[model samples]
Target: MPKSLHRRLLEKGWSEDEIERTMQMMYSDEKREKHAHFVSATHPVIYWVGLVVAIVGNLLVAVTLIPFLMILNSTQLYVILGIVGFVFGSMFNLIIKDIEHVDQTHHIVAGVFIPAIALITVYIMVSVANRFNEVINNPNPHNAIVLSAVYLITFSAPYFVYKIKDFVWERKQKASEGA
Candidate 1:
């Protein structure tokens, strides 16, 4: 049989009274739920927002690389944005009070998603900048608007994929349960 948590704690030098108190505090239903909600809400919000900012920062770098190589040195701007995003995204782990409660699948999804989005964003931005250098160089209202729309769609693709995966998984789980 697996050792009880309290037993493990005791083996690790936790006093009996301390373990009892900690268990009681941890097992309190209301407190646990509230903590879970706080973690779930804050972790993903910070992570996704940070990811978007980082991707935009990467796109800015890509823009500088292709068409704006001579005209714009936006490396500093992107660096700052990247740093901020990294700090914010890393807070997902820091803000989590209980590691055991974290969904492993979500962590895995983020691990894959962040790098994939970053690479894709850089590629798309560089390709667009190269092809549409004229529009970028001589910016007009219509062209700017169209470019922005394209960027919006490109940046949101990862999120759309995640949602689709989640939807499919949920449907499968429901079907399995029903059967």
Candidate 2:
């Protein structure tokens, strides 16, 4: 079995008092090990590729659905888009780590908000494109440009929020340690 946290800290020459204080402030070794394992098991390349596929695939579907929206009833169109959004969002949630927090808030967002946002985003894009006569009739060079930009922004939003939260938490931890 692995050594306990206290034993490892002692091996590292941490003072007894400091070790006790740190132990009180942090999770137990088992919990830390579990978290570490989870982090280590994640693959950045696979995650990024999955996210790209989710974003671009959903966006392409959205573009394709634009002309059909005029023929289909609003309810039908929404249902189809909702299904597409749910699939892509679930794919995204599965690919990304740390999105499923202990409180289950992340899970809720992954299951609900991601899909809703995706649906809304696609609707807006299609609406705007139709208004401006930029309907995506067939694949064009501009399709790549537009899809890349939109997908980049959509995929980056959640990560941006996570990074901001991490930065704030780190700053707070530093402040607390200094104090």
Candidate 3:
């Protein structure tokens, strides 16, 4: 833990990038200890309540939006659908943040979460777009263009979220194994 050893570790063929990685490892250790402390101090009911709330919120949003998409035959409705996708993705990210520990169980959860979310978002956007085009014989080319761009952005959300999730899970898995 001496300053000279830290400096030597960085200077002796170890680049600044490697030093930063080591620092990050140290930080994660601190974070893990803090999380364990928090979990020990808090009531089990709180964690369960938070988990239930996250699940229920995600479910309600999905269910309500599906029927809403079935009726969308207007540009306004497509816009609304885009907003819904954005908000739902954002909230799911927030919910995942509340999770204090990561493990193989979370690895499975993260693996399944992204594609499912992407599928739902794509389905809703396509459904809305098709319905809107049907209503107006002359489709707005710009609207279609914008919708496509939005859909691409929405598709990427799950990819990034799951990538981070997978990274966290791998780190936790390694740490747990004393690697």
Tens digits of lDDT, candidate 2, 1-179: 99998999999999999998898668777778988978755644444455457657766776776666545554564456556544554457455544344325544544454445555656576555555444545331123234334444554455556557879999999999999
lDDT of 3 at 74: 46
> What clash count does candidate 3 reach?
0
**Relative to the true structure, how large is the alpha-carbon lDDT of every model?**
0.55, 0.58, 0.58
The lDDT, on a scale of 0 to 1, for candidate 2 is 0.58
Which segments of candidate 1 are over 4 A away from where they belong?
Answer: 1-5, 12-18, 33-55, 67-157
Q: What would you estimate as the lDDT of candidate 3?
A: 0.58
lDDT of 3 at 14: 90
The runs of at least 3 residues in candidate 3 whose Cα sits more than 4 Å from the true structure, single-residue gaps closed, are: 1-52, 104-108, 114-179
* Residue 111 Cα positional deviation in candidate 2, in Å, after optimal superposition: 9.9
In candidate 1, where is summed lDDT lowest over 10 consecutive residues? 91-100
CA shift of 96, model 1, Å: 18
Q: Rank the candidates by lDDT, best first.
A: 2, 3, 1
